[model samples]
Target: MLTETYQQPLLDSIRVIDHPEAVRRFFGLLKELIDIVNLPNGDARLVFSPSRREKGVISADINFFQALRIQRPPHRRTGRGEVEYHLTVKKSCQERLASIEELVFEPITEKSDYVAVIIGQSNAHLLTHITLRSCWEDCLLELVESNKRGPHSARHNSDVYRAAEDEALLSDLIRLADDPTLAERGQNGTTVEEPEADYETESASAQQPHNLILFGPPGTGKTFALQPYLQDGNASLITFHPSYSYEEFVEGIRPEVLGNQITYRIRKGIFHKACMSAIQLAGYGTLADCLNDTPENRHRRLRKAPAHYLLIDEVNRANVASVFGDLITLLEADKRLGAENELWLTLPYSQERFGVPMNLFVVGTMNTTDRSIALLDIALRRRFSFREMVPDPGVLPIIDGIDLPQLLRTINERIEYLLDRDHQIGHAYLTNVTNQADLCDTFRDRIIPLLQEYFFNDWSKIQLVLGDNPSWGKDPEQRLIWVRKKYTASATTRLFGEIPESVDEIVTYEINPHLHRSEYDQLPVETFIRIYQKPTL
Candidate 1:
């Protein structure tokens, strides 16, 4: 008995076979012809007419029209014949061919010879030049049921009973294909396999258009990581800051001197220029050029165009609300140049129609230490995907017995524990240290000052990170006290024991907040070395 697995291939075989015997095998069995319907993609459907002798007409959906040859081989006593034909079905469409499993053929004797008659109805027609012969009755009846409640019980339950499992799997595939979360994931960004500092070429998996923001602590190589994509000559680079605005980004009316008189004229900003360039590269046309646009020409131009990238450094530094203005909606994938929901607007100043090109992809870098991402615009945040680029101490090269990577990780771990991840120092801070002196200078100048800013002059937190105790007198036997003399009395003999008579009553107090910047500066370089000295393998 033919099951789904066997019947599917048989249908595929019949669809591609052009042999006359293969044709006669089925056609000879049919008592009448119905009609042939042509499909949109150059496939055809054959319909068999229902007769009084047959309960239902059989039909097969096929792609046999593209077959190059149609000839029947020698028929055997067993009634199976081999035939060859052209045309190939794409692997993507193989499941669609399984519709043939619905067909059933009944054996009928005519003039002492047996013929097979199709005994089922289907939305799908029959494949041309392919038929079920007398010897193939078992193969055909396998598709039919026996013992009809009425006389025609053979057709009962013969209609394809679609497996619930296959239907469920297909439903799941359709749901996944249309999932809104999947689109959000695409908007957010591709996964990073390496440290953000290591700028590899954009991979094939990363080709889709998305607004990606690489954000992390300072010196995590957010800016440096964009280099590889920019190498393609399709990139436009810009730096966003607190002062950057819509006038500097999209378009604005700028004052220009025409000879002696000053006049204002509409001018394109950096983003506007980039968008225009992207549109040109994307083969989007002006109303005039579209008049002559043909499918062949458009396809040719589309093949030649490359994706354009807009790299924004320090993106979070600029006020997104002021910089994006009305253009923010255009950043969505659906609103890009060639998308279904593509949008265009007339420039307020120039009155020119403009739209963002589909080819233009936006990549931005954000320094988390400089600004809190929580403060970023919700609208902008929704439009762009954010991937955090944390410092990878492993990428830091060791220098002067200082395992910089391990040390940076240790310091960041402490900072993350004490304060938060945003306050953690990046490995880039320590990467410049080549010798002990450079390391010391880095600690005194960059690292210490930054820690001071992070801790707000609270030396206790800094001391904790350095594995030092701010309460030095905890070891009472070995103590060093710093004092500030506020006033002097007239009668004192000695400084420690008794005051001199000439010294007017003096009062001294130990300064609790004496852990100054100078104290941090004077801290021995060995102190840092000792703090992180537990060797990391």
Candidate 2:
């Protein structure tokens, strides 16, 4: 015995060079190292440590490593007590717990920024040669215990949780990740089995842009219309606005207030955070995990899975020259992550130390009505694919899951009659209906008011659309009618003053540029004179 043999097995369990399995097995406990270490069919170094020794913890030392141990079931041995295998941890795991140390025999006492150590046995070693320093230890226990049957399988998280023993499950995943064969496939590690799969991966060498431009008049639902694309797991949304500062979006010194003691921490904004997360998850093969994976594990995404969207709502509102800055590079089909070209320049927000990874698509939306997109910078316009989303009546019917034929017809007619089919609103606003009550509230809150704004009148025309009232007209009488519909009958007198509702009505009118002599025949001479009196009358 190496004097520390009893304890050595425990420490060794966590010290796999890269193979989590070998370390687990060396420490004789039970027979679950294969599962906990997650070995499938490959070779990996299993680093080991018997226990923690806190002589002094160094910061930023290249030789540093973190430790995690897996214990086996107790049993009798042939000539000695009992012996089992101990799985070795990985360099990456240890690197995660920089500035922290693991101690054994005694629980870590003072909390002066100490790392979690699988106490039984463990030790740290420097690896400055490879520039791979700062090993961290994030236990996969919660992960594997929660997910035992593997992914894309129907194994309920509860099933894994209800089990009395789950340490083996995590151990299994870790071991499997070290497998060469599984890495060949997209299952164990971030690498793909076939080189051909890179086309679909987000971190792959080849990924093209999937940009889209949303354009239409205000309130036509361009913003809501792109929600699905914006949050589509694989997609990350980056807004372009005049006041949207680089400091706010990338990295900035945010004021940190500790009572009266205030200081600034290098706080990263949403875009930077999303980029870091994308870098972390760039290797995951599946879209779901790639989109919603945890912080550390998210880095598993292997393909670039062209970030689905980069919704730029009201893109025209932004000063195009300043907003995009150098981001235009990612928009190019030739550009990809890890490219050596200057086109894909790294931001100050992410030095190698900042930990932000590259690989995202930019989809900007511009409302032509806000400003002539024609005025947009020629440099930017050429780089992006300008796809317009003009108003279309065909896009407004959302009768999913319920019999709303009558309601649909009425609403459609109102939207079309007053707002015109080209200006009709998008139906995406109503996709959230869970039941009947929800349906009605949405109609009242969203549809009814929008229609009223178009007709520039009260309830009668709206009632005509809803089949609520009989008399429907394009005359002034209908304008007040629509307004009254918004309020109760008693409040009608209160709206638009005490005048008759008919007086407050808005008569429909349209300007005619070309008219023949007969068009004015019905008008009196005084009416003709009135029309012609624009000459400083």
Candidate 3:
């Protein structure tokens, strides 16, 4: 056993590893290992001790490796003085281990003592290697059986080793060990299964909150990306604007006319209604099944319920802090109903205790042009996983000798330079353009009006974005934004027989009317191509 004096130094040495996330995960994994392998007589201090020969390296004791024990040399120091953790694997496991780049097996001696070590550059590389190693479960079971047959077998007979028997615990430890985010979740005393690749068929075992926010510029397919999760009848969509309030999101009071007299009644809002639907789908008898039951009992009663989704569009338009209220904390995966840190709140309107169910997933969309993610409420940002939906020009096809992809890309690049990436145009605007007529109509209706708003009708900047230069003397019909310079000095003299000295030449801009006129059919393909092409010197 390490003395109290030595323990602090060992922790200090581990803390100097440079990556805070990796350090956190190391401590979490250490606690789990101690719980699993350190018997009543066994000391957990043996798991990590100061190295006698190496200055920076902490000698991770071999006893801690009972579940996945290898030969004596548990760790080796590189020339740079960094420690590399390794384990000895059986021949069968070695063949399966070859596919993993992080786990490499090499000969340590003249005999068959080959050890595998993680050489990846990631901070949690060592921890990830141990959990993801091949045949780990088999080795763990073998260790348990071996301990039963040992000389001091009575020490291993207690419930201390009972956790090793749980398949769910073993699977979760292996699956979640690599994620740094899981370390944060460990603080709340809960473990969640990894989310499935297909959300529609997501497993009921996953305890992580499925809160996702898709954000990007307008017309970037933020809403379209949510289609897959909405195929079933379990999904509902709602839009938020500046006037959106918590009263409409959660439970609130509403005025109802009863026999010519106004009466105020408690009404369930969209979020409250969604929670009720999710609880019912999870096989609960009533809302009381969640509010009154303990977390453990709720966990046992939870069935393989169908997932319920609430899609919030234009999420950033409303004041999220005021809208979510105290329920924001309940949105965390570990704070959901039946979770380890389960929380409940009494509604002010109905006075009913309510909790967010794990089966309910919240997905939101934000238009970054309207609101940048940096300005979002910190509480809301922490609760949701954000996925960016930037424009992809490659998805646009060529139309009638015009490179629609390049045209869109060029315009966005200029827009990004003039304003910011959040104001750039999305490729979806050109996805439907199949011919010159379709392209003309798109620019006349959607593209031109969008640019006008984006640049605040600054004709010169808009002209530059549309590939027009005032000095080039380009044909007026060829330009998307036709510029007409009006000498205010001369205009004022003609109107009132007096010229104001303050009035100088002013440039007026308008979208070419010919784009929508009958002459559009006669317009050449060069009109669109020139938007992306370089001008001749």
Best by TM-score: 3
Q: What is the TM-score of each candidate against the true structure?
A: 0.51, 0.42, 0.60
Q: TM-score for candidate 3, please give it.
A: 0.60
Backbone clashes per model, in order?
Answer: 28, 103, 0
Q: What is the C-alpha RMSD of each candidate to the true structure, in Å?
A: 25.9, 17.5, 21.9
lDDT of 1: 0.50
Find the 10 residues in a row with the least total lDDT in model 2.
Answer: 54-63
1 against 2, candidate with superior lDDT: 1
lDDT of 3: 0.62
Q: For candidate 1, lDDT tens digit of each residue in 422-445?
A: 878877787777766677667666
Error of 3 at 299 (Å): 2.4
Off by over 4 Å in 3: 1-209, 301-304, 471-474, 488-492, 516-518
**lDDT score for candidate 2 against the true structure:** 0.39
